[model samples]
Target: MSKNIIITGTSRGIGFELVQLFAKADYNVLALSRNSKPIEALELKNVIALSFDLSKKDDYKKVESFIGSNWKQVDVLIHNAGTLLNKPFVETSMEDFEHVYKTNVFGVTELTRIAIPFMQRTSHVVTISSMGGVQGSMKFPGLAAYSSSKGAVITLTELLAEEYKETGPSFNVLALGAVQTEMLEEAFPGYQAPTTALEMAQYIFDFSLNGNKYYNGKILQVSSSTP
Candidate 1:
């Protein structure tokens, strides 16, 4: 049987491109995003686009039901839904930090817990992080909330990998560099990234499929640019 994959943040950017790559490869893909219209519009074969909000507990039920009904086993779970906060440290509020963590950190944990039951030892969990989240990486002034949340998930991924080492599913995190996506454009206007979303997504597609063979609980720095 073809591998069953679940990818979040699929409305656009890397997640959007990843879904198409998997679909073209004849893999079964479940694309999750708050705005599923773009993927639904495409009507790609071997793919199901669902409206999913990572922060909403109710939305997770949609995922559980789908997996329970159709795909009893999941091969890959990619956490790509993240929110960005461009405000300065001084301007950032508690609510701001909570909101970012909701999707980036908490949502990842919750979804992984839910997916574990359906994943075998061969399944792979790929979490998308940011270059800014890596310790000693170049620090940006206005991304305290966003960067910090990304950092949290890195540790979370590590802990999960260790805890499940003796289990079936393997977990890993990728600290990525700037990719020219709408999120980056919104956060930093006109700052052209050396990489495009599709390019990065292709790299992730390959990694998710085979990275588990070599590494688990590893943080791979996938960056060519600093900012």
Candidate 2:
């Protein structure tokens, strides 16, 4: 059987582009997203697209069950599913914070927890974060919840890498700069980004293929500027 990869948020943007890249490379991509239409439209023989909202515990639990039963080994697991809340800290409510964290942090944690048992000895776990999570960066007014959750992602990735050092899988996070995606448009509105989703996808694809060999327990700052 071909090598397997599990990636979240494959409906569009980086996740969709990643499925294309990996599928072209002959890797069996277990693509999970909230919508099945886009995945089905890909028509790639190697891609297995499952539709489920990552933020919903019940929906993600189904994913855990499917993977546990069907997958013997996962080579790479990319946590790319995330939500953006572009509201001021004062306006951000507890429910808003929980909503953002549910998908960006909690869902990722739970999915990784379930996937750990099936990961290969050299497996790599990559989480896509944001430059907004970086400290000392220009504080954008409307990203309190979003930025904090990504900060949690960075911390979570570090801890997991150290905790699993003796086990097998290597954990790392990419603190992405502005990338041209729907999410970017939603957050930054009218601002132009230096990188495109496809460009970022290529970088992530190459890293996912070989990053674990050289880097582990690190936060890779992937941005064009200090943004």
Worst 10 residues of 1 by lDDT: 159-168
Q: What's the number of clashes in each of the models? A: 1, 0
**Stretches of candidate 1 exceeding 4 Å from the true structure:** none
* C-alpha lDDT score of every prediction, in listed order: 0.94, 0.89
Candidate 2 clashing pairs? none
Which candidate number would show the highest lDDT if scored against the true structure?
Answer: 1
**What's the TM-score of each model vs. the native?**
0.98, 0.96
- In the range 61-99, model 2's lDDT, one tens digit per residue, is 777777777776888999999999998788889999999
User: What shift in Å separates residue 199 of candidate 1 from its native position after superposition?
Assistant: 0.8
Candidate 1 similarity to native, TM-score: 0.98
